[model samples]
Target: MTTTPRFKSDAFEAIHSAASGLHRSGVVGKQTMREFDALCLAEAPHFDAKSIAAIRKAAKVSQPVFAKYLNTSTSTVQKWESGAKQPSGIAARLLQVVKKHGLDVLV
Candidate 1:
């Protein structure tokens, strides 16, 4: 059998601490963490405009109400639902969150 290499927890902690220092020195804004999260969601395979719209409809919520819940505009929701437009970047990520968590996020 082939052996896998593993590092100790302290080594990982040290690397993390060094990266945090670089991040705090104007090398990286805390915003990058949020951006990275957005990227991950955007890269997630399951998100699509149709799925987002269907989720809202499935929840039996009106377009305006759903938009308000998502902190977006009614027209935007309509565009997404009708396939007249598509969400990109952070908007896509937010839709992914809404899909998984439901409208309770608004509350």
Candidate 2:
């Protein structure tokens, strides 16, 4: 899964390029690259009920299973899908990851 953020500025772009080179040269470790990638992440998008349900469908998993991957409860997934609640913080970011990379990334 790609954790790289879209380059919005030349500075960040250059930084990422340099870091990537370092990683490729073994000056940076996999764990460090992952940490850098996390720091490069953009703000998570807000998912409406329909969008949340669509993502869940795309993953081809039941609500309970999706919740398990997301480290949330089935009831929370239901609430999000039903528009009774919204996922914020890490939860929202995780949904974005699953939406972009697929459910297997979490596994």
Candidate 3:
């Protein structure tokens, strides 16, 4: 919470308000709920390759070690660094958490 958020407070507040209205309407289906859960899990900070690499380097971990910490493969880490692929789903969110809250969240 020490870091300033990327979003403006009013923008975030509006988004939350919309979500609250949706919930109040009781129109959220099971499929919608599942999708929402996925969104929550993968709410990435939108880091690019350089940023991703910086984070790993900052953690003082090699690619393989970072992969192990993420329960993924070094190849995936390489792909992220190379921009061959973007980290998605839970992995992206986890990285965001690490960036904001420190790497200890994985532990």
Candidate 4:
């Protein structure tokens, strides 16, 4: 039998809704890079080396182009793909957004 992830999804939505509410109010203010990193870490899907490579390839962008779009270095992107390093924090979030929303986030 197959099971549904209704409860887990509900929890994610609740946390996201609270974050949205804080943003709507003046309490949260604008998201700084650090805060954005934290939020993305909390909310975005985690990417493995294969996933990172797939995302870049799926976007039909070269490593350097993807690096430029992420404001990172081509060496870093290569490291991520080779699993010498992981895309944590901002890079991870950007990768997730790109996976979900496409390369439009670049333009």
Report every candidate's CA lDDT. 0.68, 0.88, 0.76, 0.77
Residue lDDT tens for model 2, 43-105: 567999999999999989999999999999999999999999999878998999999999999
Tell me the spans in candidate 3 whose CA falls farther than 4 Å from its real position: 1-43
Off by over 4 Å in 4: 1-44
List the RMSD of every prediction in angstroms. 11.1, 8.8, 7.6, 11.0
lDDT of 3 by residue, 3-80 (tens): 332333565655645664687788666577555445433244577999999999989889999999889999999999
Q: RMSD of candidate 2 to the true fold?
A: 8.8
**How do the residues 1-107 of candidate 4 rate in per-residue lDDT, one tens digit apiece?**
66322223556656655665777776666664336435533443577889999999999999999999999999999999998998876688788889989988768
Which candidate number would show the highest TM-score if scored against the true structure? 2
What TM-score fits each model? 0.53, 0.62, 0.60, 0.60
Backbone collision tally, model 3: 0
lDDT, model 4, position 71: 94
Candidate 1: stretches off by over 4 Å:
1-47
User: Which lDDT value does model 4 have at 12?
Assistant: 62
Ranking by TM-score: 2, 3, 4, 1
